[model samples]
Target: MGTRWTISTPEPLPADAVDAVDAEIDRIDRAWSRFRDDSMVADMARQAGRYPIADTDQPLVDWYRRLYDLTGGAVSPLVGQTLADAGYDAIYTLRASARVPVAPAWDAVIGEHAGALELREPALLDVGAAGKGFAVDRVAEIVGDSFDDFVVDAGGDMVISPRSRGLRVALEHPSDATKAIGVVSVAGGAICASASNRRVWADWHHIVDPRTASPAREVLATWVIAPSAMEADGLATALFFTPAAFLRGDFDHHREGFHHVTIRRNGSVEHTAIPGLELFL
Candidate 1:
């Protein structure tokens, strides 16, 4: 939620429209942000009880479930306390705490429920992985009719206007933030990047494998392009633990259309051959 988001439009957005968009962003943060107060997710975390599930928050719960299955629980929306244990909690002005919080069981945090969405455990949920991408997608949907060509970028997750000519996108180096590992031209759909080094504090970064309750080893970053930003965002996180090939299903034929670039810790890179897109190193 600390990331900066930008909405680029070919035409100027009306002042009221801009305010409306900002309000929507704030609303999303309030619903999903565990670090902040009065958020529906945060409220659930505090009380650990049943509450009426907000319709807007349903997508997050749904996506988390899909991602949990996709990555075999490697990426989840319910790793808040694990992150806090690794010193990724609020009050960042102070040094990171060494105490490790237990990573909630995926079943405990997001088990099947017939009626409504509820947190049944002492859960601290952080949706940073794919949430921003979802937000980008939502904003794109909200503004689709207003603009002919535009890009909505939140951190590295981007939703670009559909075009025949691909948009040149620079893939940033995970270890060295200033450098580019590769560049790709995106033809259509949304692109999201997940890296291990961006939010380093006390020698620890943001990404933590829910299984080990520790930082994921190897693989600097992953980029995924999908028809939907939410899917792209979730897949980007999924690619962190598993290889790009695993994301393909029987229905996908050979390619998942999920072009991924995995930058190793040693500075080497491996990327899938995406259809209609070329990578330049």
Candidate 2:
């Protein structure tokens, strides 16, 4: 929630539209920000118990549900409370806390309810994984008619549309922030990257495996490029914690397109299984 977000355009906006767009971004920041005092998320969490059935914010909740099945429940809506217990509260800022050993699939602070869109157990769903991506996607949707060459980056998740030159995206090294292992060219659509090193705390970070209840320390980072930012966002989160054995080589075939990169803890790049994906490197 304290992450920095940047939006860029290759072309200048109309004088009249600049102020409007800037204002929209601020509005979005307030609505989407968890740190805001009157944030919609806070109200929702408070009112969840009284609702007919607990549910997440629209479009995102729908998207999360879809990806949950696709990733075999590796990603879930019931991870919010458990994540907080792991030192990731509403704020991303880290604080010193005693380390609690998580037994396999042990979540200490969650309750069962039918509020989740997906009928899952002990779920504490948090949309942090996809919230930034969705915010960028919303910006893209709002400005889609205005420009073809534009990019929206919330934290590290991004969506690009090329009106002229193609998008050149760099893959940040998982271990070294200033280093980049490879650069991927994106012509149109979305790209999402999840790193274990980022948003991490003292032996505890943002990434949480719902089934495992323990912080996943295997892979360092995973980058996903897909047709929609939502899909890319969800998959990046899922694959970031997904065991290597479950993934099909470097990439798995999707009904749409397949292009991705995974960086191991040791800093080696794995190209997607698709034949031409090597070109992204």
Please provide, for model 1 over 156-238, each residue's C-alpha lDDT reduced to its tens digit, 9 standing for 90 to 100. 78999888898888888676789876777887688998888877776677788887777776877888878767878888777
> RMSD in angstroms, candidate 2?
5.1
Cα deviation at 62, candidate 1, in Å, is 1.3
**Which stretches of candidate 2 lie above 4 Å from their native place?**
15-33, 50-57, 91-125, 163-165, 243-255, 266-268, 273-281
Q: What TM-score, computed on C-alpha atoms, does each candidate reach?
A: 0.90, 0.75
The reply for model 1, stretches above 4 Å from the true place, is 93-98, 112-115, 250-256, 275-281
Cα error, candidate 1, residue 177 (Å):
2.3
Residue pairs with clashing backbones, model 2: 54-115, 77-125, 78-123, 78-124, 78-125, 79-124, 80-124
Candidate with top TM-score is 1
Error of 2 at 130 (Å): 1.2
